[model samples]
Target chain A: MSLILKAFPLGFLINHDLSEEENVSRDLRFERENLCLIKIATNLRLEDVNYLMENLGIPYKYKNDNYFLNNGLCVHWESYQGHYSVFISANEKTLFEKTKRYVDLIKQGELLFKNFDIMLKRNTRDVNSKEIFYYCYKTNFRTRLDVLEALKKHQMENILSNTENEIRFKYNNKNYKFKRNNKKEMFYIELEQKISLVNIGSGKKSLIVKNLKTNYTNMDALLKTLTERGAFSVHSDKYNIYCEMSGMQFLFSRNNTRGQYFLSVDRVSDEELCTNILKELDEEYGLNIQDIVYKKIMERIKDKNMRIESEEVQDDNSIVLTIDLG
Target chain B: MGKLKIKLLPDGTIEMETKGIKGKKCLDYAKVLEQLADAKTEKISKTDEYYQNSYLELDESQHLSDN
Candidate 1:
């Protein structure tokens, strides 16, 4: 989803209805998806603890996958089919403490994500469970609309929407759903599958597989999916972004900073179809894309007659250039 | 006949493969793509394509001429 967390107000998780024994045996919890984890003890007032533990179960990342890390101390809310639990064994004192350390660091984490787009929420993983204050911040723009506008300005034609309030489209073979939520009074958008054009899956060999698997627009759906599949991530590097002209999908990309655009057709299994599409693109759009990219680059630099210095390299998929300021 | 397949990955990787080309000549095409995409080689598998007959010689400019 385009819902990037920009800021988070620090809050505390408290337990007021604790019996002296319940207080000693129960631990305070943190709430989150990737950041929060809590165990459900049967002695608590939760009625369906047994049922949920049996049916929904904890995330497989905990039970099956080698994904958990002893990063920070944060115990979060665990919900199952409308039932919620936020307590764990006081015996997990070490985990609870470590998770707490992370929770406390979240106060510091606020500074780390202040300028960047991120999604955030407040943890109220306590016994007095009620409506908690959850917040999300968009890091890339003042608001989500700005993202939509920029996308439209660059590539708007490939879309179908019921009113401008909500739009759904496929770009690069991935579905994008963007819409305004009237009830929450927020605009939300999500990529059907996470695609990074920069080919950055985790960036490095880190065990922390980012569990960005939540549907921020629909928390109910998010919870249900989590309960069904558990937390998991599968990395795919082979993907495509395409544009249509004359009933053919041409792989397309627009690099504004580089001032370049690319379109190509390949492996379509039908050579005739490919030839036909190629003819249309050549006749309608022309074959001189280098000129188009050069012009666009000049326009971006605000000097229509700017002299450009460009380099194209072979034996490596790269082009490097420098603008002579002198 | 040889063909070039270019792929743009979700993880921000650009990959190109040469099909039906013989011998070290595929590397010539691959080098051109590598230059275009500007990505460092993370892994390379020398398939049978690298072992087949060197049917053509590459010029200094990489244009292939039949041996």
Candidate 2:
């Protein structure tokens, strides 16, 4: 006896009986030899299975001794000639491909973290009032020590000697500021004035920050609102203190803040990565990915309550935010 | 019984339209799809059918009572 695993589509079994002699004759085409196993992958809920058994005019029984349901996939195994064949079924490989694609996409970022590469993306914007702010960025470390150094720097333990990336710092009050400085780029800070407010829109309470102030007028206001509402804190970089707020993050050296112009961290790079990720998903999965990936990316930055918004300005211009000020 | 049309929008959102349903029953039909998709209704439009059925039922009862 040999073992072979097969995935069967559940839709095919909806109204078909596999046990009856007549039914068996019809479904024998689906049966395979090697006397081992049968597996079915199904997206049906238990209630659906029961409903089908009762109302779908189909007679079917569990073929394998093993029965379990998980993550929209049902698995079962049948024994033949002292061997087993496993069967799993789902729709059009979409479920499998989608799950695999999702896992792969997440892993791509996670691998950066695991490998110790600082994968960073940043955006900046302005608002009428300083009530709320939101931001998101990613950086991967190359090694455990790199992660430790980055986190330690984030925690403001030891300052890095080189590279004046934007950093975050917390003042005496709960007030937070994100600062960054490059040779050519000026430094700026985002200040949040209040927590957040919930307003009814189209019958649902949409979390929003009414008044917000930012250093730049061209910056997206919705991004600022999300950052201000999200959970954030100050961390240290090698030479700068950084504010990590939701998804919008920046490092600031003390010297970078002398002027009043609130410089936005690299928005182009941030938007590019976002566009790349979405493009990749759309190309690979053939499914139009929503903001969920970006939302999850923002959520992973910190464990806190937050909201995010993304807006497109130009063909190459966009902004995103993560806030948990409430 | 009025038929309820529930559609999963292209954006992966659920939109529910209740035809010949009125009052709380419209909500009931909407809730069924809502529960199925774990979704919140973003916008709801009260159709002419809804208002017509609601008023027609009231008018029929009023006419019968007059007899």
Candidate 3:
């Protein structure tokens, strides 16, 4: 009986309708004051943010967790995340413009891609047409590696000087010399020739010259017999007779030095295919370039008198850092 | 003293906040941090604190001679 309880505040009870509108306005303002929203480019990691803060000479205290952002601002930083509603004051908008510009500049430097040389370094070979034709002989669509293995398995006994860079052998009373360039995967056969008499019509003999061409035909027939058991297909384009096999084009052209024809296998590079492969790499592991940016940022921050409060890995593999700028 | 809090998600996105700093100085700080982080600022909304003024201090000394 001595204590009186009021169900509502005195002002709210006095001005019910006006107070209702005011209360709504005040609630909205409170929400706006508590939260600031930001969306950053996706793929930025915790360490990256820390590095950036350090470069900016901002210090923070550390706490590691995946807790939701409750104060100041919440960032929609992950690319996979959807959009969020944000409210910004007019004066504070200017501050963001500068930040936006810096973000663009940093992204320009960090998001770099690897070129052909770096992408295909391991698969690259110093290709020479003459060299490839000699050692990497192929029939139909079989691979160069397959043909080479077959030759090795069948002709191991006939090999005269078989080393890392050279494989010289005598087969069918004819010498075959295959040499690989030093520090190169390409192999070349030194020019060798054999001349003989061939029977012509009406009891007569004609003088004929044979070189790599004859051996090429013989080897072609032999490998075809062993593998596909089919005839070799030939293609010609004006000055050269060629055979396309497993990303390689073997061409037989006249060699003026020996007055004979020699085989030359050139690699047919598919630009579109290479481009697709590089694109795939960029899509799969492209974010690695950000590491360079992080490193550069850390470099700028080093010895800058900023203090790191805490650093940790969250359940989602994200990193959190707090720094204090004293 | 000024403070910064940073979060890096596994997907390579960065979340950052500045505390105990206000006004245009915060903007400058944001710009520098974004540049160092190599991230683009897609969206930015200022909190109430961003509209508040920051503090400044000056150090000075006075000397007097006695006869």
Best by DockQ: 3
Choose 1 or 2, whichever is better by TM-score. 2
Cα lDDT of model 3 by residue, A161-268, tens digit? 545666555544445555545634444333132211112112212223222342222222223322332113455443445554323344566534223346553432
Worst 10 residues of 2 chain A by lDDT: A119-128
Give the C-alpha lDDT of model 3: 0.37
Range of the 10 consecutive residues with the lowest summed lDDT in candidate 1 chain A = A196-205
CAPRI-style class, candidate 1: incorrect
After TM-score superposition, the amount by which residue A193's alpha carbon in candidate 2 deviates from its true location, in angstroms, is 40
Q: Return the candidate ranking by TM-score, descending.
A: 3, 2, 1
TM-scores for all predictions: 0.19, 0.22, 0.28
- Candidate 1 achieves a global lDDT of 0.35
Provide the overall lDDT of each model, using Cα atoms, as 2-decimal numbers.
0.35, 0.32, 0.37
Give the lDDT of residue A132 in candidate 2.
30
Residue A316 of model 3 has an lDDT of 67
